[model samples]
Target: MNVFVSLLRTGVPALGGWLVALAARHGLHIDGDAVAGVLTPTAVFLYYTVFRFAEEHVSPRFGWLLGYARPPEYKALPA
Candidate 1:
């Protein structure tokens, strides 16, 4: 799971930047700096949401791959 999360953390930003670069190459009128400012935060939000969801819902075995001992649960704690 850690591996998956790590990959997402890195890959999302890289993919966003790559897309921005590709757009620039194709003569898109977008401002690279402005796009980067937007893309980076969006990627971060996506990565965080995915990671949190996986941590809560994925099987323990797969979670272990990401160094999670177990999937998170919503049960209430002892009073």
Candidate 2:
């Protein structure tokens, strides 16, 4: 379920953005309740449909080209 995990990791932020846009469209201020409302199944479907394609073409790089380093919190996780 790597794909599912990846979707969840990305979907949360996209859902937030969708809620923000919905609020802005109606000239309403965004808050936690607004965000929750916007993050319905429809919003998640739209975000997943768009971002899955984008993610497919992007490659990961670590410890090269970017002077990459793992965060200390990452090391502490049980593996």
TM-score of each: 0.41, 0.34
**8-64 per-residue lDDT for model 1 (tens digits):** 545544565556455554575677677666765665566446655675676435444
Across 3-55, the per-residue lDDT of candidate 2 in tens digits comes to 54444555564655576457554665567565556555456556545444444
Question: Candidate 2 regions off by >4 Å?
Answer: 1-7, 10-14, 17-21, 24-39, 58-79
Which candidate should be chosen as best, given lDDT against the real structure? Answer: 1
Model 1 TM-score (2 dp): 0.41
Local error of candidate 1 at residue 77 (angstroms): 17
Where does model 1 exceed 4 Å of error? 1-29, 60-79
Cα miss at 49, model 2 (Å)? 0.9
Positional deviation of residue 59's Cα in model 2 after best superposition, in angstroms: 5.7
User: Per model, how many backbone clashes are there?
Assistant: 3, 0
